[model samples]
Target: MASEEIQIKTDYITLGQFLKLTNVVESGGMVKLFLSEYPVFVNDSQDQRRGKKLYPGDSISIPEVGTYTVTRENA
Candidate 1:
């Protein structure tokens, strides 16, 4: 599937926050279950940490869900 672009004004964002930002999960409550049930890829590597720091140009991919690409924007 085609990846969705998510622009961030900050330098970095956490995986869990990003999930919620992208509406991947309904709420923060789903983050634990989502992480345990699905595989999360950060820049193509499987990562389990919700606190994973995503920098500019980083991409996150989840199977069965859309990929989110992080882009930096000047504030």
Candidate 2:
């Protein structure tokens, strides 16, 4: 079966910023809380850090929400 892909463009974003950009969390504190309770998958692996830095070409998956492909936009 074919997989669905969602692309996001940004320069350099931390895990917290990514969550905000994706409308996953409203604030940093909320991001932290969600990270601690929910399983965030990075490149198909479980990532449990809210401070993890994310760059271009990084893929993140959240259960039920699907996957997102990160792409850096030129400055």
Q: Against the true structure, what is every candidate's RMSD?
A: 1.0, 2.8
Clashing pairs in 1: none
Model 2 TM-score, 2 decimals: 0.79
CA lDDT, every prediction? 0.89, 0.76
Which of the numbered candidates is closest to the native, going by highest TM-score?
1
lDDT of 1 at 40: 95
The best candidate by lDDT is: 1
Per-residue C-alpha lDDT of model 2 across residues 1-75, encoded as one tens digit per residue: 223443446555787888887888988779878888889998788988877877777788888766787775655
lDDT at residue 41 of model 1 (Cα atoms): 93
The estimated TM-scores of all candidates read 0.91, 0.79
Off by over 4 Å in 1: none
